[model samples]
Target: MENKLIVSSSPHVRSNQDTSYIMKQVVIATFVTMVGMLLKAYIPALGDALGLFIPLIVVNCLILARAESFASKNTPIKSAVDGIGMGLGFTLALTALGVVREILGNGTLFGMGLFGASYQPALLFILPPGAFLSLGFLLAGFNKLKNKKA
Candidate 1:
């Protein structure tokens, strides 16, 4: 029964939980983080809107569309693995961009001032173009790596 459950046509399983489930999970997580941001905004020590929540939602939607369109029909286990991989990929990509931007734009990592006070920050790294350029290149790199492995 287990073997049969794992085998089928090109897509090995069918279920009600498709890309929508993944998207819903991601949206929920994002909303939770956004609420944290809102709380920080109200605090005197952290009173800035990072603008991350909106982009996170957009990225989550894109991921949902891709997963639903490509991975939904696969076996449940496979689909779950794929979802985890995609989530990790998204997180790593985002973290890399944030690290680069923070180091260049603020001369610090976690506000510790790694580069010292003499360092002149590149303010553009925190701007919209920085996110686009970083994400675009990271995506291209991921595609290249995936194709090479394939």
Candidate 2:
């Protein structure tokens, strides 16, 4: 097997490394980022602010998707870069989503009250159902822009 020349499907170049090996490397590289998120989660000033969403980025679909789609076929450095971009993108999107949900559900932004105490929060936005609905809408909007750009 070591002497064999393995072929990959069209357009993508290949290496002898298996999927598991590439995935492991990608995961290891991204682990550094996951730790930073955990650290932020423990930090007082920011923990309660956005910590809840930080750690979850480790398993974010964006990162995993990039790892499987790009890392498995690319060089280590490129894979690492892809992972970094995906990681940052994932975190940023989540942060924005959290902000939107927080503002709409609690009438607050960055823990600071918005629209005053008189403002009533939309209780649904804070709930799981609303979260999924919000995510769906966001994805739809993103897809629209992406298709238009393409």
Candidate 3:
């Protein structure tokens, strides 16, 4: 006769994987991408090199914590997909915020002044609080869209 073991949670079921493993993968992926971006910025001397990596590192740490707490037990494919989704989402949000701030603060997109000399730029849009305010409203907008779909 073959012997078998019963797996359960609180007297029910259990699995081989756990949260830590998933989190490690997420951290590795995030680090890989951030490092790539850093190298790109450093080599070409493009954009705000220091600021770019700082935000990436900050967001990566936040994602790492979340993945450890919630995503580690899942399968590799699922975890990868989730990580990609989150990365893309973060990129989109940041890009949108950057675009708004750049256009408003510099009166330009990609450093070209659209408003010419007549427009006085709003300096506040480029400040730290601007990023937070933009993100807050973006989150609210996303929530509204989600609610509408449901």
Clashing pairs in 2: none
What TM-scores do the predictions have?
Answer: 0.55, 0.54, 0.56
Taken over the whole model, the C-alpha lDDT of each candidate is 0.67, 0.68, 0.66
Per-residue error at 82 for model 2, in Å? 0.2
| lDDT for each residue of candidate 1 in 1-150, tens digit (9 for 90 to 100) | 322233322251334335434545555556656665666767634434544554466566667766775574688788888989998987887799888788877889986998777889888778978767766766798899999999
* Model 3 local distance difference test score: 0.66
lDDT of 2 by residue, 35-94 (tens): 666666677676557655654554554356557778768999998888888878878988
Estimate, for each residue in 1-150, the C-alpha lDDT of model 3 and write its tens digit: 000122222222124345433444455556656766766667655534553564556566666766664575788788888888887877887799889788877889986879989999888878978777767877899899999999
TM-score: which candidate is best? 3
Judged by lDDT against the true structure, how good is candidate 1?
0.67
